[model samples]
Target: MPRTPRTFTVSDSIVVAASPEAVYGQVSRPALTGRWSPENLGATVHGTGGADRETYVGMVFDGHNKRGPARWSTRCTVTAADAGERFAFRVHAIGLRTPRLRGPIA
Candidate 1:
């Protein structure tokens, strides 16, 4: 039989858990995220209450000129998330990023 069509996209996901709101609260904060994520060595929140930006510092990579080998360096802020059910952040060098969501996994 022909392979089933893939309906899911890289931006789609299903979170098997209860209380998405609760989980969002814990993960929304940068400091909290850092505590929960081992890859994140440290995270600091800037700006003021309600409106804040998260600056992250962790192991990252950087590519040099042509024929140059990749170099590892401390990565910096990749995204600035506002207070909400859905938040976004970026990680450099790792060539990957993530989005935090709350209230029912989509």
Candidate 2:
């Protein structure tokens, strides 16, 4: 069997009532990542520095809905960054989908 090639595009923006540095910190912060997305439990950094970049390991918490506490893991690549200005990452799952979730700080 062969899998069909699928492509999808999506974009979104958010305005944060904080400084750009604050916004950037929140984006890089592992604990704060979940606050942005409910599916995200938390993240773990595997390296150091922003120029070279690092690995962000995010976990998904399982809610007791129809299913029990199911834990899932996902990896994101910090593709783009500009200190306290902008940042971007690509979420890897079954397919390579670049989730360009970005916003400004207030």
User: Which model scores highest in lDDT?
Assistant: 2
Which pairs clash in model 1?
A: 61-93
Instruction: Summarize candidate 2's per-residue lDDT along 1-106 as a digit string, tens digits.
Output: 9998666666788786899887777775544566776556555444454323432333221111111364444445555666686666655532112223332211
**What would you estimate as the lDDT of candidate 1?**
0.39
| TM-score top scorer | 2
lDDT of 1 by residue, 5-53 (tens): 5543246566747576566566555555446554453343344442143
- Runs off by more than 4 Å, candidate 1: 1-14, 49-85, 91-106
Please give the distance, in angstroms, between residue 87's alpha carbon in candidate 1 and its true position after superposition.
1.5
lDDT of each: 0.39, 0.48
Q: What is the model-wide C-alpha lDDT for candidate 2?
A: 0.48
